[model samples]
Target: MRRHTIRPLAALAATGALALTGCAADDGTAGEGTSPGDGGRTLHAQRVMQLTQVHPQTGMTLLEGPTFDEEGRLLVVDVTAPAGEPKVIRVDLDEETAQPLHTDDRGAYTSAQFSPYDGRLYLTDFAGGAVVSLAPDGGDPHTFFSGDVDGAPMNPDDLAFDPEGNLYLSDSRGMREGEPLGRVVRIDRDGEEATVLADGLAATNGISFDAGYDGLWISELLENRISYLHLDAEGGVASRHTAVHVDGGIAQTDSIAVDADGNLYQALHGRPAMLVYSPHGEHLATVEIPAGHQGLESATNVAIVPGGTTAYLTVSGPAGGYLYSFEALAEGTRQSNGG
Candidate 1:
């Protein structure tokens, strides 16, 4: 398993905020913005909420799956917290407070999004290999979808919904080093069936629809890369190609969110920053935590509020889970929430 050990905050604070430049892949494609100090835009995020929960194994909390509901409430899941602890939480940005909404004895929910068709919050239980649902008020947790796909078990990490309410989730299981085992599965609107849109991925972690909803932007954590999959009318993969290959050093790519103009916000699991890329895979900007807030090193997921430029990031480390806010490169839409 990957290590979650927290490093010294003072050493991380010295780096300050960073501005990066994109690097070219071996195939001459735009990979990611790994070269720092390119004079790009650097925005410092302000902390919004801090969770007090801690995981016994890792000695710190890990947050992911940030999304905003139609009512503009910020929701996130604590992937490291155990049973009896708050596994899911709602944050009050103005008041800087959090409320426990759900908990489970064996569920390790890695992502959460509200379905457009059903108006219910859906969570991807990574540990249970199932998709769970809850009422808007975070009550009545239900098992929305579970079971094997083609005789193979699932390990869902993150999920997103299309305008028509079709569910798409990332299966992170079957990863075997050079032998990729991750896949993107699309469940029908009614949750009666599922189709594998793309497969042979390396630790698929994030999934989001494009601005036009004709394609999907997927992040492969172990590969440190992103891919764009053009979808056909039936939601099958029409064409797929590498998008952004990030060289994160000790960090790995986590959840991602897209802006209205097609800018992708890629979050890093072990780093204290987020890298923004244009639709064409061009590096746009780097959003980072300020010096004093560098203690929160796990910048794992981001959610941009629809119709607004404000972006909220879910970060956690030794200090605990936290929500931070920064300005995005473009306005956000429903695609901006939950990946």
Candidate 2:
């Protein structure tokens, strides 16, 4: 297990004060932020798909999860799509086309992941408070986990699976107004058992394992903080600490992906960009849309395909939903594949 250490206040300033320009110094020299426009080594993401008409009931769309199936096709979910509209979409990168994979009136899936153990797709339903599963072909849909854990209702938002195939979920209950009812849950490989690994979080939105699988990185939307939970041999949290905390920003930290080199790619909710940070919380780079494409500001999640540095981000807002691509900091691993 890696030991935790407190970073200097300058490093904290580099992370919290997002307006400053330049990369963070490992020696705590305090330079921070990339340039406002596209110059400061900003990776201008290219659009891959257009989902302008996905949501009929609400003109606005919210694309949350972006994961690659075993066959390397991109899969994402439309959280704002009403009943009778397609919620799950599969994108073919080679063809640059998207098609609906699943639609159900009872589901408001916020994230989708392909489980490593069963080789099936699993989705987290935020509104329905359940985890659902299906084959990659979108057949034989089944509820993987539901109801309550520890006698408390849960709103499952995002999920991750450990190397052993155990599932970890982020329960985003009571997070809209910053309520502290959020929780982290763990389920067995077969989905027959569940446990509340941690609780009392304010809008636990995204969950992902680190490069080493030694811990988990959790993003809290309301607080704009990333908490690292060091895990023991049994996948239990042994300790906790804030790894990244950005203060006074309209951008809410949403979904995150970890590279094989331990760098973190964090998607910003209100801003059309992704923040790259080192494992020690050093600000690395800001991947954003080009200057003219400002309409795509509601970036939500990121998915880096396994064994490669190519990464895709999910964004939605006035221009509807979009899939953007950029080069990742390092080669993607199992930790980067989902949620």
Candidate 3:
């Protein structure tokens, strides 16, 4: 299924037809037996909805972010979706409706995270090498941070925040080739500047802070490993270690999200699947995308609803801009500010 030109907002605005088909929520949920109290890791997942199938007016070959706001709206971004069409969209989880919010001609966009404190959306422009931001209503796009140290390009992939309002980003300068130029950075409480936390990485990808703010995880794409960062009292990286290192030609790791109990849900590349691991690097469960589903190829990042047993995913590939919800066995770690 090559990417198609589905201008959903334009089509919906003209013809009041919002095609939300092929979406159903099932009772069988994931993480049923896999719980923190049980002292074990391993869970199952049941598909709830295939985004494109539910709303067939989206075309994206590169889909990534799936962050939600406190208002129950999920912010989804596409990179050169429909070939050179980069845009940010919002989906009402309550009503199951989709709408385009903003479009950028500057460069390919990768991720957009809604900030609770500032009431804005933080975005990563892969080609332009900058961290931009905007209002929740998709207004006033401006550069929040740009450039890089040593006068190099800023190739940021994913972003995460700590309990104290510090921001962390994975800089994938040369990720595709697994170059060691990748790095992990952190911003201060005022968001005025960023400092390098760790360097000499191999295509650093997704990132997530533990629920307790005790650890931070960074994905090393092409290397099939997830780096675990031990935090000091102030949330700085005290020690860095590889928590989940997949070998035997398994798969490449992408974005990651953490649950309340410190369970990490990671997306795999070589195939469409989700791998859950315990905090101790214990292999918990592998959730495989159902075949013949609406959109399963190129499954990338995941956003688990807080206190809700559901994990919403953003998938791309031949058919892009797909959103999915799966039965999660546990609750996701909520932000300190209740975002």
Sort every candidate by TM-score, greatest first.
1, 2, 3
Clashes of each: 1, 0, 4
After the best TM-score superposition of candidate 1, give how far the Cα of residue 171 lies from its true spot, in angstroms: 0.8
Candidate 3's residue-wise lDDT over 1-339, tens digit each? 323433212122224332221345645544544544435444454554444432223334556778777777777776554322437777787777677778765645667776545767888776666888888888898888887755556677788876555678887654333336778878664668778888878767778887777877888875778888888886677998887786515456777888877777787654566777777887776665554654445557787776776677776555444665665547764531111
TM-score of 2: 0.86
When 2 and 3 are scored with lDDT, the better candidate is: 2
| lDDT to native, each model | 0.78, 0.76, 0.65
Q: Write the per-residue lDDT of candidate 2 for residues 97-185, one digit (tens) a residue.
A: 77889888788688888888888999997766799998899889999888989998777878999977899998875433334777899
Tens-digit lDDT track for model 1 on 1-339?
324564322112123311100111121221223336665577777766566545665466778888887767788888767678888888766565678889877787889999889899999877667999999888998898999987777778889888899999988754443577788999987889988888888778878899999999999877889999999998888999998988788888888888899989898877888888898988778887766653567788888878988888887877667777788888988888857
- What lDDT score goes with residue 32 in model 2? 29
Q: Which number leads on lDDT?
A: 1
Candidate 3, run of 10 with poorest lDDT: 5-14
- Total clashing pairs in model 3: 4
Relative to the true structure, candidate 3 has a C-alpha RMSD (angstroms) of 8.0
Lowest-scoring 10 consecutive residues by lDDT in candidate 2? 18-27
Best by TM-score: 1
